[model samples]
Target: MGRRILVVDDEPDILELTRLSLVREGYEVETAATGEEALACLRRSRPDLVVLDLMLPDRPGTDVCRVIRTTPELSDVAVIMLTARGDEVDRIVGFELGADDYVTKPFSPRELGLRVKAILRRGVEEKTESEHLKQHGLELDLSRHRCLHRDEEIALTAKEFLLLAALMRRPGRVLTRERLLEEVWGEGIAVTLRTVDTHMKRLREKLGPAGDLIDTVRGVGYRFRE
Candidate 1:
């Protein structure tokens, strides 16, 4: 009941629907029809989470997300990418731009609402108090679909994030490429080794100076610093 969410989209219909869902969940909601408006609104008041449409009227949704991720003022805000685009590359782009989660278009409102709530809850945790080696300097609130590093928040695409989380959980232990693919991309799904490499490159770049956090084991797989 205390949460506030900002929804940015060019579509009036979807905006209205998303607003209705969040409002029903007992949270304050703000809607923007353009990326410029969303940026302006966010500048005035920080929201608990952001539902960002991949397509926008002014700049590309990826650009908007980049701005949010790079800004110190809005660093902690959790962002969920909402767009009609479902391509793997698009998802990686969203993550590289610092998105906490990715949800394709025509997604269920009920499911979205649950995800929104979870993301919000995850954003507020204190990572130092957490038990696991847990990727220090980085705090991942899975409920909120957001990640924070060195007290500065970092956005990750859904898959990159999943991969990061999976590796982090096993800190110091090497996870084979096949195992990572299975855990992050889903078992029985046919994928390429290049796909894994590409996502890893993107993830490392966004991690900035901390890119070495994920280590390539060579002839084996990858390992996260314990």
Candidate 2:
């Protein structure tokens, strides 16, 4: 079967529209109209990606996003926030909460579809690269999407793994924020430079002592230590 997607939105029109658009893209689409229902659906059937609306009837989308991130079973699920709010703070909050992407309310279904495609495509690309990379006692099994710090497994979100992979693939080369954005998040997505900073911080923390491998280049960007 095609990749599955769960679209959560209180508006019936949006739920139907998003389902239709995604279905046309060959995705298996399911939807929920409330946060409670969405969580229930998630427990029953895990989707590859969730197109979540920020404003919901029963709960704020941020809460739901947080739940997904904190739930071990749901940590790998990609989320794209759909909201009418376009404020920078809202965007920052969404990203900080582990949203994979954010789309403003007045959005084109085609564009949203493309964004979903990009996110999913990136996930696939990550798995097909070089099988293994080792540096300073950190081991990354790119094909298996596993990371090890001195033989102890380190759990990483999809974004965190990808960001680390991008840096390691070009060790010693300073990757500007814009370059990392394109390499890790893909092109044409609505994400800010600070988003890179947020993921990098989390990535570093997860890497533990190996965190120092990723060096900050002051105002320019980050580079994996040579």
Task: Supply the global lDDT for candidate 1.
Answer: 0.83
The residue pairs in collision within model 1 are 95-157, 98-155, 118-143, 119-143, 119-144
Score every model by TM-score: 0.54, 0.57
What does each candidate score in C-alpha RMSD? 18.6, 17.7
Clashing pairs in 2: none
**For residues 1-226, could you state the per-residue lDDT of candidate 2 as single tens digits?**
2299999999899889989999998999999999999999988899888999988999999889999999999987888888786785455445578888888888889999999999888876765566688888888898788999989999999999999988888889899989988988899878998999999999989888899999999988999988
Q: Tens digits of per-residue lDDT for model 1 on 1-226?
A: 2298999999899999999988998989999989999999889989878899988989888888888988999977888888676785455445577787778889888978988877777775543334333465866776666777887888899998898888888889999989999999899999996788899999999999888988899999989988
Predictions in order: lDDT: 0.83, 0.88
**193: Cα error in model 1, Å:** 67
List candidate 1 segments past 4 Å from native.
Answer: 89-95, 127-226
